[model samples]
Target: MSMDAPTFRVGVVVERRPSKSPWVDHAWRIVAIIPEAIGTEPGHVLGHDGEAVLLYAGARSVEFHRVETGNYRDNLTSGSPGLWVTLALTDEEPGIRLISVTADPAEGESLTEIGDLMVEIAPMPPEIAERLAAFVETHHVERVFTKRKRQ
Candidate 1:
């Protein structure tokens, strides 16, 4: 088995809006994933639609593991394959940071289960989906599963 893993870099575009709930001041949501990185400041505002401000939080990598090619293929065939984005906040940065993005639903859900990081999913762009499909094609290996008898 090869240890090589392919990664795709994406700009995590976040939507920042005033929170209606009193518990928090602002509500942050992952709105989109730019398939390619735009060489701009992380906190640069891309647009505001009166309801929310869109900002480029930071760049994150979507890594494809050789062993998880099956999951990637499942995601692509799920009819609504998505790019999952994970965001986190820290005292070091004083703002949200793009931690990770993945095409594998299981990994994405595991990150969401962490309970601290904010996770969101957006429809995967056709181009990126194609690239992922190609990666799956190149790295995917079929394994036979055998059920074990209980003692």
Candidate 2:
């Protein structure tokens, strides 16, 4: 982790409906907090008036969202809150791929005004999650099932 880089808690927003209960609203929950490196040295540069001019290269911004296994299973079972991840440009600098994880998909939409943003909301890659599995497993609490008493 870079000392200057900022860390963000990634989350998956699930919309779900239960047969026994009313539909549940979109719920955003944290999955992992990771530090992301944003700065990279420009490949080519030219000197102009004692100042280095960076060569322009065509590049697009991208965001990645990681959804935990447990959350994904619940979403599938409930069949409601569609799987979505919030993505936005990092506050540190523009044109850099530093996405902050959010629970609100709307926030991702709002980040791109013209709808040209390239934000990807997909299942959390196993390798990526593996790095933080210990943290999640230690903190995550599994729900216990208990029979309800009849009235």
Candidate 3:
């Protein structure tokens, strides 16, 4: 996607398991107007600033949730009272399209390719969401350090 400010609602999804349930659930949502990036990178560094999403079941209402790309280790060290990973972002769509990590659709699925970045969405609070949206709105990505040379 382009670097310009996003005009559509960004949907954030996170992987979760209910306290009393065994199966995992990707239950989180951060519907906001902001800029998001998709590129090649080892692992993923979810947020631009310190802001991100924290997708759990009942901590907050759906309107306040968010998600970004990250791993388990990131969650433990996130420093937030209850740190969570914000995996991926997408425009408003129906029936958990390819963007929905829980949907677990196959490769070449409907979603656009995000290069080496695996979808690692997480959930967050409203305060953090505002910070993230602002950061993403103005940040410029550098690819010189990310390029691999052909031998």
TM-score of each: 0.87, 0.28, 0.19
Candidate number that wins on TM-score, 1 or 3: 1
Reference-based lDDT, each prediction: 0.82, 0.34, 0.31
Error of 3 at 7 (Å): 27
**Which residue ranges in model 1 land beyond 4 Å of their true spot?**
1-3, 90-94
- Please report the TM-score between candidate 2 and the true structure: 0.28
TM-score of 1: 0.87
Model 2 residue 56 lDDT score: 18
Tens digits of per-residue lDDT, candidate 3, 54-106, equal 33211211121122212222332355312222233233322122223221122
Return the candidate ranking by TM-score, descending. Answer: 1, 2, 3
Clashes of 2: 5
Candidate 1: C-alpha lDDT? 0.82
For residues 77-140, write the lDDT of model 1, one tens digit per residue: 9999998888886554326777888888998899988877988887898888998898889889
Q: Whole-model lDDT, candidate 2?
A: 0.34
TM-score computed on alpha carbons, candidate 3: 0.19
Better of 2 and 3 by TM-score: 2
Report the error of model 3 at residue 28, Å.
20
The better-scoring model by lDDT among 1 and 3 is 1
Candidate 1 least-lDDT 10 residues? 89-98
Task: Report the number of clashing residue pairs per model.
Answer: 0, 5, 19
